[model samples]
Target: MAYDADTSIDLTQYRSLIDLIESSAKRYGDKTAYVCLGKATSFNEIERDSRYFAAYLQHHTELQVGDRIAIQLPNITQFVIAAYGAIRAGLVLVNTNPLYTERELIHQFNDSGAKALVVLSDLLPTLNNVVASTQLKTVITTHALDLIAPQPQSQCEFTTITFTKVLAEGSCLAFTPVSAKLEDLAALQYTGGTTGLSKGAMLSHRNLIANAMQIKSRLSDRLVQGEEIFVAPLPVYHIYAFMVNLVLYFERGGCSVLIPNPRDIASLIKTLSEHPFTGFAGLNTLFVGLCHQPEFKSLNFSHLKVTISGGTALTQAAANVWQATTGCTISEGYGLSETSPVVSLNAPGLEQLGTIGKPVIETQVKILDLNDQEVPPGETGELAVKGPQVMSGYWNKPQETAMVMTQDGYFKTGDIAIATEDGFHKIVDRKKDMIIVSGFNVYPNEVEEVLSAHKEILECAVIGVEHEHSGEAVKAVIVLSSLSQDLEQTKADILRYCREQLTAYKVPKIIEFMESLPKSTVGKILRRELRN
Candidate 1:
């Protein structure tokens, strides 16, 4: 395959993701592809296992081509196997958050109409309660250490199979080939919607393939194929990590060490000490958290060359601390799930500290004003994007898809940004009332909807408040059904109620009680007034 200088990608290289995977496996057969929990899987081994998984889906299940399969696992070896296998089996992948509540799970599963679920064994109990409510027909579960060590057999009420058993059974079946086109839907990536329900971004094989190529073009000079080792702590289910680790790094014949739980700084630092990692992908809060630890500062940084930040803004304090501690500079990028997650990234050695750097090759980015007209350079406006990597549209929701796209074919990102004369882009503000805490997006509507479900809550509004730790913290203004003299106890009770229904980041950090929430003439809660 030849690299195109004009478009920045060689479209003649491969047809689909399967083509890329098969070619890389053959090119780097004996090379280590992924390492997790002290176990390394080579490219050949990954190819074989994924083929066996595809065989199982073809012969055992009633699922047909184009059916959706939901994968609800964290960073693990099985996640890679299941995702690739699903694609190979001609099924669409739906990446599900493992931390999602039952209500969230129900909406995503039902909305996507996923026919099969590949999930962690620990989450099977949660799945058990919701599987009956979904369209799931086949359930495969695996332990975190299933690939590394043997586990005692556990019983379940549902008709479920263990991950190891599936692999063993699949090996007996003959694999069949299926034709998939670049325009075929590969995955349904769910993102927070303005209407309070999560919507699936219909990402095609071309979108994923194009984004991978664009990233490669941007960082080709720094990346050495078959030689680089990446420390992947961010969840692979997210599009940012998914494209960088599973797609780009895999295509480059590089090895990625997956961290199942990145919240454990002690464990993460210990893992870092064991490898001569050449690349690392993280965010602002993660960089700050790890750099502040003495154990992390003691690790060897001689082999570290690339440190990419995305999913949220990177603070200068975090960047400076990281550079001073590890002798490696942080390169921040910007994108959303709708764009296969990367629109622009700062190239190493030419990074601009607070800017997102230049747009990727073949991608068009513009700032548009309220009237959908292109804004002048240096003026803040809604950032819009047009590229092959952008999603076709939201799944099963044409109206919602039409709402985000303009007549000119650009996807309107609800973010305010300014383009510098030098071609760098800087984010100024967000057009939506969404809070980003530690790189995770927390939608106010979702939080407020969950909080309003509490029996004692009469009305509530959620707002983003500035925080020293997380970029923003969720704050709730509430008007109770009945006036309570014990305000402190009532606040505690409401918080306790929230933890059950919402994820930790989505839960409000501070709660204030008001006699009545401020409303507009139209009778809607004025969140801007609450923010003031």
Candidate 2:
């Protein structure tokens, strides 16, 4: 079923991601596509640069058709180029967090078996420690100058180079053009597991393209092609922001105001004031942070048409505050890593407070009980989704893949929700023990498993706590068999170990000691009791 419109085309019909970028460039060549700092990048430049990067990859490196290429950069121009370059060069793209520790980086690099990596220069120290252990053969590094123009002084002291200089070291090899099908693998998005492991979700080109088109089609009414500006504060490595900010932005030829560091409210607010943004995509924490800042009240949001909230449940208080201040509600949505990150969203025009709107085009959503039977409307049950955006499966994990993927192709989202009579769905809670800190998933089991290895801890349980900015923060409750003289130092040591092992978001912000954790008669730890 192809959606027909005079100006809109089915984005999934394209064979490669580059095809959409190329077509949009031709249609809106002179229009600004992205803005950073004070400078703007036109669609023509984005197209030309991505093409050059693709040609460079084909010229250098043994990257062949269907090979996986890792992109480990921040929200910079090189990221977009490397992403489209690999896809156009017929290579599967592997998205990695730029702040990953050596252990985290090595796991994803080795698991994906990617042959090449494109990284930012300042993050080289982290990558340098791990690349030796992976099967990666080529490395491409970019400087800050590659993305933003020269600064008056070094606000950030990080080493990086242009892609031209990095590619000069290797001999260029012939790469196949866009010959892969839309159903072929395009990305391997690695998500943290329930069992304290990370597994890559294989998202095909069709999966991503379908999501982009579906989102674009829905927003097409209010969104004017080549005239709208999208605030991309969320990282593109995350699928929710990637589809809306990166993929859909390109599809509609809209300008993306890139926020390099969203954690810094001052800088993010400065960017918001610098541009005439029409659409803003972020989670609850970002909005809460914006409202907390003293200068936030003065920021102009009259041009803004929509605010998309995902990555976690948005509270009624946060939504009400944003609406009162900006005259626009933060539209909440629901998804998981396996569903290309977006299965349902509250359409901008039909947004309902506290609900993750309706299902997008060509998508089916259902609420099922423990017996897989459909639950009545307004009844709490597990949310299951079937759509083109659903991932193929977990990479190389058939047993794990079969566990989540239903026989009829629906992906179990592991989120407890209820559909209202009006067709809007609200998330009651998560069935999995995953903590969302500042819109990033922090698996408590993984944190607890790491804390248990501490010499001072006999057993530990990690849970989420109400946070002002992060929405939810990791808190560790531990049982110590032996009491040490320096308990404070021991707690510090435990946190330090977790920082070294896990991502910063997964680290525990609060550490509390307990005699023993409440458990069921069968010896299963009661996480619900910990929440109380």
Candidate 3:
């Protein structure tokens, strides 16, 4: 099939995600769209369910168009329904992390001013505790098996409804169409803030649609619409997976096998064994972990064609192991939550092992020095991007948005990279202090804030250190309140406190107690000094 660069996949044809979904569902009605826990949902089924959920929002709730609704669930069939339904109803989707602590949850919900939330039943207790802190008017919950099988009725203290109940009730109600333009805000993808808070990246419909089209164009030669099956272990809430599996692949009429918990290597391997997946989306740590599993290595790789590596840098060791085990080369890409998550991806069979391949279609990448002047090719500098897929700005944060955007309209990526003479881009280092653990962003300020809040701790500093398993591990240097004879027990106490407050990955793996941390004249703890 000869792919047309201009008209093969026109992104401008769809104004919103609803338009995209409606067209795709109509085109591939009977094709399987998503599979989770042995239950497969066809394209038509996803469309119907998403419409029902949207109707429920329209009739059952007071939420107006463009209102933010938080979705905090793991990768499941319910997540897909909730996301598409929220977007279709003209609501701004807030992709919440399911593992967020109460403090993190409070900040995001309050910051986004989410009027509604669709969360997992398992996380109801956590939501219950924090519901009073937000402006949420409605709460809907669903279990992992809710779509697969019937569940017994359960009641909650707050006014909450079940996911099935919404679908049932909304099926009978009329779905009033909401006019969402391409320039309308679609999702508020929150990125880690250096100020110890998370800021939402305002992604418009055009931003998402354009990136999906850009990604589709890059992989058009390898991907067969309605024929490819993708193994999506990464959380759909993350932009990388959201754009690839949910938007791009979904529009391509591909089947996505959702692994709710990829951390469970045994279950992940078991899931992979059942499907002859042609595509896999993952990162360096996940790639290394899966390739190390003997059972994973034994799985059928005859059908696997493209395996994508993103979120963090792909090490040569991981790439070698994955190719040796699966017979599929890792196509590493680079992007941020601000860029609708994809600036460039490696061309499917012609992947350069270490570098994130050339910039995707309609995307411009430039390496600039401190003076904002473009550097010579092959020289290291800050990578700046300009494309239709770039986010408009941070949600409700003008000053922060101004800080990231250049006068000439490029978004500063904060990553140091070198554009090769061969057109490939290689990431040299991160200009920011953000730590990536298993492809999840972990900022030192957020972790340090939680640690310093402990009554037993006087002060602390956090930094990313190289690790064999996770690409980077959070390492903490602490200054104790007082001299303690039992330093080991004190360290244990501090870690226990962190576990209660911070997420699992943000908790420090290595803790070192010191009299004082290296600091500048202003008393700001030098994280780079700590890293060294």
- TM-score against truth, every candidate: 0.97, 0.92, 0.97
Worst 10 residues of 1 by lDDT: 1-10
By lDDT, the best candidate is: 1
**Candidate 2 runs further than 4 Å off:** 1-13, 148-162, 166-176
Candidate 3 residue spans exceeding 4 A from truth: 1-9, 152-156
The digit string of per-residue lDDT tens for model 3 on 234-253 reads 99999988998889899899
Query: lDDT of each prediction vs. the true structure?
Result: 0.90, 0.79, 0.89
CA deviation > 4 Å runs, candidate 1:
1-7, 153-155
Q: Count the backbone clashes (under 3 Å) in each candidate.
A: 0, 5, 0
TM-score of 2: 0.92
| Model 2, span 129-166: residue lDDT tens | 67678888777777656655432222222333457554
